[model samples]
Target: MKKSLVLLFIIITHQAYSQSVAKYSNEFMNIGVDAAAFGMGNAVVANINDVNSGYWNPAGLIGLEDKQMALMHSSYFANIALYDYAAFAMPIDDRSAWGISLIRFGVDDILNTTQLIDSQGNIDFNRISLFSTADYGITFSYARKLPVQGLNYGINAKVIRRIIGDFASSWGFGFDLGIQFKHKDWKFGLMARDITTTFNTWSIDEDLFSAVSDQIPTQDLPETTEITIPKLQFGVARSFTFSYDYTLTAEVDLNMRFAETNDIISTSFASITPAVGLQFAYTDLVFLRAGVGNFQNENNFGSESLTFQPNIGIGFKYKGIQVDYALTDIGDQSAAVYSNVFSLKIDWSLFR
Candidate 1:
């Protein structure tokens, strides 16, 4: 009865918060890996031996025993091209662990346009072209178990880069901090991402020209512009087991904008999401999971629509090799069809 009440409270509170504001980033990273979505985003506390822990919650790495590695890839709708992530984690000693991860997101075949000017110094024609943009991040992470109790904490420092064809490129840095605790059958976790508001400054090249009496003369043009990416995110999750193989988990997350930036469009409005998921495992080798969150709410669109919902996943393991897959809809216009994503993950550990 207590568990049921707690779950109800989480749902009601999240719904109330979701109505206030709605916006999120790293949408590609949020679809989540296979095993995680199944656990209702409870990975911070649930992950035990998964290599993707580098992305989910680095603090979880503290429990790792052997060197672990994983690769994951997914495809988004409209050929938007999503992220490919790879991570590696190893124990530095009995009390410490270190990890590294790489992620890449790219858009293929984007149309580029250029304005054509006539001798009269007036626009004549528009030229259509094609180009691509890519974003990548490399992360270094470390974690340690606290001596006071069953607590674990970690941090990740990342170097981020963005590229837009041959015209522009920018660089920046960011960080993530996380904590996890587990005792008996109860688990708790929290993580704050993008703690530092980082931005990529681009260097632009411009050729200036002045028109006088139908004659054009070239002039000096300043090159470069600075654009900032605001940072904010906080997530918490808890889980309880009903038996050895059956478990339920709940997660709540809040995303806020930096006070320094107030532009509505430029600023990501604060939003909250809460989710519930169920897991069924058979002898720990095979598992099935499902979850639902932010379904039919106005902040995400309207109460009549569902954004994140009905996620399902499966996993299989043999020896030290693990494979997982998940399917989910991330609230796109064509979510029922094109917005769906298929994810694949592979994990290998040298020791059990």
Candidate 2:
């Protein structure tokens, strides 16, 4: 049965590969949802556990004990943008688990300068309009342990919505699949994201663009479609025990975007995106994480040095409750610098 399922997935992916991916349809979905995961440079594919696994790698959810719930919130890019996430997970019988989660990213009160000056030729600050852009998604996730002991597989179904004030909006749907294999202190993982080629059919009218075209050229525009290319993530992790009181886990993940073979780079596979993360824990009470990733090294120091992605996080777990905090880079330190992420988790054992 697993073989058949795998074959079906391959066929569907092959069919969707012909379509081109667009920009910003469900882009918020790419932001790391968990503080611990983000602190590790978004390298949780093989090192995931807890409720946030619903977004990182649902396959990791099967390992969760009892029922769990988590909540997270953060502000990005100097507080101009905000992100929030929540999830719940519980085991089903002995071999499977189910999870549900939601994510929201928004930028509020953006100034619209279309009507900066009034007809009377006097500058009017009131004429400046404020609007918002928001992207939201709800996900249903399931994970099951394979008959082969240490192997697990999972899937996620997502419903997404994007809004830009009252001017434009879009609705989209997508799916993700993941697998994990663990051997002693080592683990491996793979994730197929947007497997069916997530696409958003935008609803836009000329009225929204006609005004801006007056300054440039009044060219006709057609309907627009936003497509999200399928992405594959490969990860591996190893745990090292320094002593009975302390343990450290190191992990790395590689991201390959299948649709980019034909894009602006022209070369097949283009460049690889590598993420590395480390976690230090004392028994099961406290955890510290540091990571760096998402670096597109163009080999030019001047331009490449400008790209920065780093994170640090700490967590505390006691009596089935966990609290985590992370600080991640947002932009250049000169302008808007960093973002803070906080999350809380409650395990069923505490309630029992």
> For candidate 2, lDDT tens digit of each residue in 1-352?
2233224323322232224245223657887787888788888899787788899899999888899999999997678888999999999978899999999988888666656655676777777677777788999999999999799999999998877665556788899999999999899999888999787766654585544445423222222566786788899999998868899999999877753331223246443577889999999899999987766434354553324477889999999988989888644321224789998888989988
Clashing pairs in 1: 112-129, 296-305
Cα error, residue 18 of model 1, in Å, equals 22
TM-score of 2: 0.82
lDDT of 1 by residue, 1-352 (tens): 2233224323322332222222222333344443445434333334343456677677888878788777766666555666577778888998989988888877767543332445565754354345666778788889999985878888888787666565446566667777777776555666666666444444533221121212211211112332233433345555566567655444554434443222222224443445556656665677676665543333444434335455666777677676766665433422333323334444344353
| Candidate 1 lDDT trough over 10 residues, lowest sum | 213-222
Model 2 lDDT at residue 305? 34
For each of the candidates, give the backbone clash count: 2, 1
lDDT of each: 0.55, 0.76
- Give the CA lDDT, 0 to 100, for residue 143 in model 2: 97
lDDT of 2 at 281: 96
- TM-score per model over all chains: 0.69, 0.82
Worst 10 residues of 2 by lDDT: 9-18
lDDT of 2: 0.76
